[model samples]
Target: MHGGGAVLELAELAFRELALFAAFGFLLGALDNLAIDLLWLRRMIRRLAGRRDAAPWAIADLPAPDRPGRHAVFIPAWDEAAVIRAMLENTVWRFAGQDYRLFVGCYPNDPATRAEIEAVARRAANVRMVVCPDPGPTTKADCLNTLWRALEREEADSGTRFKSVILHDAEDVVHPEEIALFDRLIERHDLVQIPVVPLPHPRSRWVAGHYCDEFAEAHGKDLVIRDSLHAGVPSAGVGCALARDALGALAAERGGLPFDADSLTEDYELGLSLAERGRSGTFVRCRGGDSQGLIAVQAHFPATLAEAVRQKTRWVAGIALYGWERLGWHGGVADFWMRVRDRSTILAALVLLAAYLAMLIGFVLLIAALATDYTLPPMTPVLALLLGINFGLLLWRLAVRAMFTGFVYGRREAMRAVPRAIVSNIIAMIAARRAMTHYVFARRDRPPAWDKTRHIFPETAVPRP
Candidate 1:
């Protein structure tokens, strides 16, 4: 009986401490999120006012050039033979008339991918396969650099310059109007990014559907606000175009290769580094009209928990750890604030874990009190106020998430976002923990290798609204 009393007392103390910590951290995050929401609302109002008179620009897709400017598309592949052929063929069919060329980087060792790309190159006049000098499994950035070198040679031989360069993954199902959209916007911005919609995986609703929800909210609401504020927009690493001049600027400053080979998230850094160099980036979310609902890239993300965690671990490690080490806080006010938001995910995950543990302990304590006759200690006034505010913020956050999700994916998926949020939280927490253990404290001498998850292109077309 005495030991039970002692254990009860200890559990209560732990619960109180955990609750306090979670409440404080979550309160800060809630306030930050609320600020972004309010800012988005202001931007929406201004956009409505601007369109108060003229026809909506979204009714029709952006005008395409009769002879679109010469553009280069770079896709780096390593052990991606399964999906490369389909992706390249689809791209060839969709971009049939665009004045663009495909430059696929393959490894000499990964003959499967090389053979697949080689097959496509043989049939398509504009398709060029770039074999990397290095062996297999080098960083994606290195492969991109190899492709860039090949493009430079082609430019020298053909006496033609690409207007811009687009980055894409092997699994992406690209929009036909993507190049035209970028060409239209590249006149004003150094880097132009489009939305990325993860194809819904009906088989893995919890693991894969969470990405659909998260990206819908992110690209739908968060990035829109960032672009409106003129803040530095992080690249989604796909569906993004960098002005040839911008790439040249970075390459000139970088002594040769524009991309950092050492970084895990070279594409994320590419846009931010350009921003640091006084270049501008924009995130455009526009309708493509007709069967093409949104002018964005669609791809299949990880459909299993293990795969999802593996993919996100690299993201957490790259952004939260390596990003901080390389690109510290050094931009304008909005840029700095956005960077802070990017780095806050890991800490937020920790707080969430603590909150979950606290809730479990509280439930157990409640059972104990109901079974016996002992009353628990009263809550602190500060904690009570914090809890009340947090509860309200939680509901608001969910509603906003659903709204943004439904805005893109329709009503049913928006409803799924509620339960899927729990799955997202769990994956984030595990990935954050793994990131801290692997990248944060690992040996510095080990070279960065390819951390890419296996590719699985959607076998069928993803139905668009």
Candidate 2:
């Protein structure tokens, strides 16, 4: 009898623990959602009422060119053969009249990528290839380091000077006007962040919608809010331009350390590093009518659900491991505010875990009451009202985005992605947690080789329009 009683007590304790944890998680999630809503409100107000010129950081305007600005398009590739040629073609066509040089970085082992780049470079006069030494660590940062060394050597060999180095992934098609935008922005700020949008893929799977959601929130609301308050914007990895002086300063400061070689998402880390060193960032408009902000980049979102999860998981892990840790030390008021933006997935995961446990417990209790013929108190009207308001905020925010971005998605397509986003976020949180834990727990280490995301582009995929 005592043993049975003890067992019951243990079970009760476990349930209580879970219930408390779950409740806390739900509250956290609710708060995160509220934060996003507040950000969206700030963005909308700024767009409607703010002066376009008054905000120096809003958009870049190019000066009339007597002498063209000296710049280089630094494209770093690792096994990107699937979309390299398309990117090159788009880049050349867009920046044809500009005074920019091309530096295509490739790994020795990636023969397919090298061959494609080589073929494209032959037709393009200004494009030059920098082949990095083989047995590379499959990270963009590593490629950047190799490219930077070559760039420094080239700069030494020739007396030529470059004003800025623009970074892009091999798969992205940069907007033609980005050069003009950067020219204006560079006159004021040392670093500029361009917006990223997924290439239009209507028939693409659930990943397309997920990408759209991210681009809308990150570029439209999150960045707009940051710009309104003069806060630092997180790097989109690609589509950003860095002044040559800033690059030199960063390299000098770190000695031989590759800026982004530590984790999967090197672009984000590089952006954060600049801010950590007291560099201010200007948000160049990448979208909207007659606005230079919507510089189109023909890039693919992960086509399969697994690819989406894998890609997001990598971001989650890398941001936690590299971004949070570096910012943890030198973070100021700006950093604190930005943490609310950067920790979206972490906040979402905690909330989902909490809400699920809470409802599960509530349902189980209600079922037991029914089976035992016992009268149970119904959930109070006040509690019901609170829950409804909580969900209302979420739907309103999502609906606002849907209305503007016009759902290229149907009911079946949209419905399928809803649960996938939730699951994908959970996986992302797990990846983030694992990366943070590893970084904290491990002692001395070599560079971590990340699991590569396999491309799932359609067999009939053509260049993005």
lDDT of each: 0.87, 0.65
Deviation (Å) of 281 in candidate 2: 0.6
RMSD per model, one decimal: 2.7, 4.4
Model 2 reaches what TM-score against the true structure? 0.82
- Per-residue lDDT of 440 in model 2: 69
Q: In candidate 1, which residue ranges exceed 4 Å CA deviation?
A: 1-4, 51-56, 59-68, 289-291, 462-465
Best by lDDT: 1
Model 1, global lDDT: 0.87
What is the Cα-based lDDT of residue 166 in candidate 2? 87
> Local error of candidate 2 at 167, Å?
1.0
